[model samples]
Target: MGGNGKFHKWKIFYRPSPSKSDETHRREPPPKEFICPICECLMFDPVVVSSGETFDRLCVRVCRDLNFTPSLSDGSIPDFSTVIPNLAFKSTIVNWCSKSSAAPPQPPDYSSVERIVRGLMSRQGGAEEGKSRIRCTEMELIDAVAEMPDVNLSHAVTELAHRVNHFYSSSSEESVVMTTNPPTPLPLATRPACLSLSSASTSDEILNPNPNSEDEEFVAKFNSHDVYEQEQGVVALRKITRSDEHCRISLCTPRLLSALKPLLISRYVAVQANAVAVLVNLSLEKTNKIKIVRSGIVPPLIDVLKGGFSESQEHAAGALFSLSLEDDNKTVIGVLGALPPLLHSLRSESERTRQDSALALYHLSHILTNRLKLVKLGAIPTLLVMLQSGDLAGRVLLVLWNLANCAEGRSAMLDQNAVEVLVGMLRRNEFDSESIRENCVAALYALGHGSLRFKGLAKEAGAIEVLKEVEKGGSERAREKARRILLMLRGREDGEEGDRDGILELGGLSRTRHRVGGGVGKNATIANSTEF
Candidate 1:
């Protein structure tokens, strides 16, 4: 009975064998959506373009760099103007890879993709040349005419002139017979000949003349495979856009921006530096600011800030500062992680980079979200260090004033012992510009208003003595803020509610809230008063 039970268990656990066809069959390839339209490789970083087509980010960048547009299977051209990440498609590709037990796709090397694009461009060029060869050919049909004897040509010309005169005379007589010979005008026959010649000249000009030929040539050089040519292209663009406002507006097209995008992060120092400098020029026009940001150029600018050549980093910081002047770009710049690098750049050995980075931070920190981000990134400590070192003191103070407007910033400032730094600067009269002194006082005022801890920190730093001096000798704006800060600090000392009530009832620092140098409110004092 035991043997029979064991046999029964074996029979119950038995399974069917696999067929030969099943073993021989292979896994299917990944779906087409996984492939980049430009590189024809499995996409790792898929981004959707304006035309609603998905492509690898690197692939799109290469296309923009080369100024090459590939035709899709449906014969549509993908718009390379703007691109945003396609997170849903990327997640799908990952899932598909996992289920198939296949290695996930990785971004193809940029050079390899570039080579592929160049090849496609070459092939397309050859085909287009073949189709337009006859039309574009410069054959000299006049040579045959020139070869004829002079006598025969003269005779032919005379014969044609005789027939034209006869036709004109006949028409003129008819006109004379019909009307009372109204002042004899140029013959109708001559009119056709003249009109034909004028139309021919106009058509020739329209077909052959190009006013922007120089700019177009420069733009074409950027698409060259040679790095030197690319460098020359960027240098020429920089020069043209620097002084010519018209060129700045005209060259700020989507196509040119697309071509200039990749070179902004070029590995070559000259190329990257000049490319970013050109971007700075392009961004000088107010209209180009938002367009440049929309072209997805900010990320490369940020990358330049983080790791580019020193010269390129300076231009990158300047470019960011230029872009930040536009209110629409402030949130975008901060959101794309520019705050930390800009903060980090404050300590750079290059003075221009430090100043530009500081100014950029000042403008960007005006946004509430950006102020919070700066605080979270520990900017207060760095700014305090730079402030005490007297590197870009006025600009650094402006950034601190903006930070003082936010609650998180105020807390961060208190935590970083900012009160002592400002008080010490005031007591020592370290600033050269009265505006900087005023900014210092305004920042302290903001800190006092936002956080109660400011009272304790200021008292420890002997802020009362510094405020008295500022009240006595500083500008009217500085004196007012100084008195208000003194009242807040003095209120803390007297332990009297009326002291607090008087501080508030003194119009709640009404003079500080008045517009200073066209400033709208208390917060605008630093932004408007200091000209970084």
Candidate 2:
């Protein structure tokens, strides 16, 4: 990224050997060190690497280029060790010793397969040797393993896919482990960690060990069966970087994301939010989102949003909002305990953050889905306080508009005097006259559709007077809208009486309110109903 990302003709390099006939063909100086020969940089401590061929980052271009190769003639094994040599170490040392640097050899265009393979085989870590070096993050290591000879990167990735409950299983593991790559050999304590790979199934002794009450002879036999893994010196929770972009990793072998979880549960706000955002990015897939929501992470996630700084809060809020959109995650936050943090974000200093929070709350309150949750979580009052801020008015209205999409939302809107506040706004033209007014009216219409309560409140609050005046000389759209509202009101001014006896019902209501929905129907006794 630092050097010019320009492409050069393929100056293919051939290994020079003494046996070649010089008369028939002269050997060149290793093709003029094609493709930079080597980046004069430090190797990852105890490790050295080089790309036998060069390919651009994006995998699409390689296919078009005839030079790129996706598979070997056999496609049976990887040819990295054969086709590509780790020659960068020697070349880099040579370049550094003699400062007379020449332009790196330009290589031929990469073929499609080459591009894809190169992309799949991304090279990381050409670090300076002196300074503290970083450990490859779980992803970096995974990418390395994926690119290795004979191993199918895609297949390796799929081995831990969500289909086999891998997502849930992984989430349930140590968070620290989840955060990094895999288990690394830490300094072996007196009672060091013994590792084993239970890729498919485990032995009887490991899967279900006998209780202490079991016969000692039987238990002793099982104890001898414990598997010990290859132990090598490894840094857990080490920084993962390519000398420029850096990430952190916990271990090297078994699983990432699950490894650094312990560190993530730090008391520091930045630490918590950082951990959550990293996980959030990694959990971009649907299964990941679903698994996290179900894993008991909502509380910690909420805490980060509620207690962290503006940026951290924003990150947490964004993560929760993302989870709110997924079908599997929609109800999980509320059920799993993410409500409070979401409400907290509404009052945040950042506008984008507040908007996202409001949007999440809006979705949560869709009809009867999480409307009760909204009320129970005390979202209404927070939503109201937010409306007081000029910056929040637009988003507040947007949320209201979407919430109105559901039947229970409409009912709650009318029951909570949501009608009263909205009517007051319309009566005095409190919001912006164009788009704001349109959105407000739209919200009112949705609420009124479920029950005549909204219509009655609007009339009594003198909203009708304002609507009538606006309709008198207003645009055709405004006039048509007011006329319809009037119809819904059925000329009633008091909510005690309605034109029709339609019941817009939800399960959770006050004991006195009628229960008219399926699922967890409880008391809908929340007097602050409309507020949240």
Candidate 3:
């Protein structure tokens, strides 16, 4: 069986070449679905725009930057308002490349895509008219593209193209067309208020008299039977909320929230991602955080966290993290059962998802009820595994710090052999951040409040030796925590009945109780006050 296993490995490593016919078949061009609409090449990072069209991410960015839209074969203009990573499609392309023994596509160069867009724009007018038409200087065009943001560039390009087309359609005999200087760009604070695209407008000019009119339009589009309109509404809202805090405040009404709720779970990747991202933006406003939580948005956000598109899951985790920052939303979020899914997200393939999940769990664990729930949900073992794996060690340690604050949490940590893992990291100097090391010692200090089992565990894990070193060379916080933990460990090892005073001392309690000879008097108070 061992020889057969080795033979199979060898066969996989050294396969024979295919015949001419098979080679010819394997070398066929990638399918149309894999080809980017703008560059007409196999997409390296295919992303879905709000129009439900897939294009390379770079192509989309370049087109948006140049203020030129690709004219698709179907003669439809894609909505470039939002772009969401089509991860499943990208994965399929990768698998096809592997099976066919074909090289995977690389990202198209920016200059190359820019050149293609320029060619398309030039073709918008007749070839003869191109030579006769007065054009903006190349340097001026470069300066305009450099100074403008994506939205401004789109509007500027559209306006420029409109002027050129109008100029050519006229029968005026004058040859020299004096180009007026472009208007000075508005400050960023005023930019979002003036965004007026052909399909969408974010100017709050009508918001005062008819507040719900704009929101009503978006909600109508959001609830439409047409998926493209739904995508356009959500994407526009996403962009608007991201740019203007006022829009975030105004658009977070219950009616808009209700309209957005279903799209959070939409089957379309672009809609789902942008919808959740819009929620994240809404949650950023301090006043909107609790409003969003109370609007029954937490459940769908949790659903997205569980099984939505990968990009949407990242935004969902971010939204939860943002919401969890509010004191009132913390317990409510935990009650909505965000803990398990959030704990699962700590292992997500996306680093942003993992980071946000860890932070959300950390904030939620601040409440005593939530901490106990986390212990019940088996978070200690999962976190310990992630910590040992050295993924997001600093952020993971922050969550562990919160988990270590409760009795059930401390007990769970000891049972999961957390001491060995933490001490192993400290002894090896595994982390470069002093804050991470301090957090490690702080977690150990919190666990020191446990029963004699912690002492045995600490001794077995060689924690005392490591703590002493931390005391000598670590930060002031690390040294202080290490000092207290060392005192507790020695006090326990000394076997003195009054050593409970030493434990109380580690809890920052007065040693006046030393003469009391037992920990019965203020043990509960000490335990409660000393939680990290």
Best by lDDT, which number? 3
Which digits, one per residue and each the tens of the lDDT, describe model 2 over residues 1-532? 4356585567899997655355225422333323221221222111111112322222223222322223323221111111112344446635643443433333333353364344533431222122212323322432332211342222111011111211111111111121111121110000001101212111121222222222232223222322110000001011111010112111111123323232233433333333444444433333445545533345545655665545456656656665565555665455545666677767677754675677666555543546666665656656655555555565576566555656655565666677777776777676544545655555566567646556567778877777777678654555656666776676642332211111111101122322112112243221110000
lDDT of each: 0.65, 0.41, 0.66
User: Best to worst by TM-score, what's the order?
Assistant: 1, 3, 2
Across 1-532, the per-residue lDDT of candidate 3 in tens digits comes to 7666654544457678889878868597778889987778889998865445678999878776765655578754554544567776799999999987788888778898889877777776555233332323222422332211223212111110111211100001111111121111000010111112222233332122233335888889888988667767776676566556567788888678867977787766666777887787677666777778755667667878888778779889878887787777887687667899999988889866886788788778879878988889888888898888898776677678777777788888988999899999999998745656766776777777746788889999999899989999986667877877788888743222223233223323333422112343334121110000
TM-score of 1: 0.56
Model 3 earns a TM-score of 0.54
Q: For residues 218-319, write the lDDT of model 1, one tens digit per residue.
A: 567677878767766776666555455667777887668767877776666656777887787777666777778766677767778887877678778878
TM-score of each: 0.56, 0.42, 0.54
Better of 1 and 2 by lDDT: 1
Per-residue lDDT, model 1, residue 405, is 78
Top-down lDDT ranking: 3, 1, 2
Give the C-alpha miss distance for residue 35 in model 2, angstroms. 61
Candidate 1 minimal-lDDT segment of 10 residues: 189-198
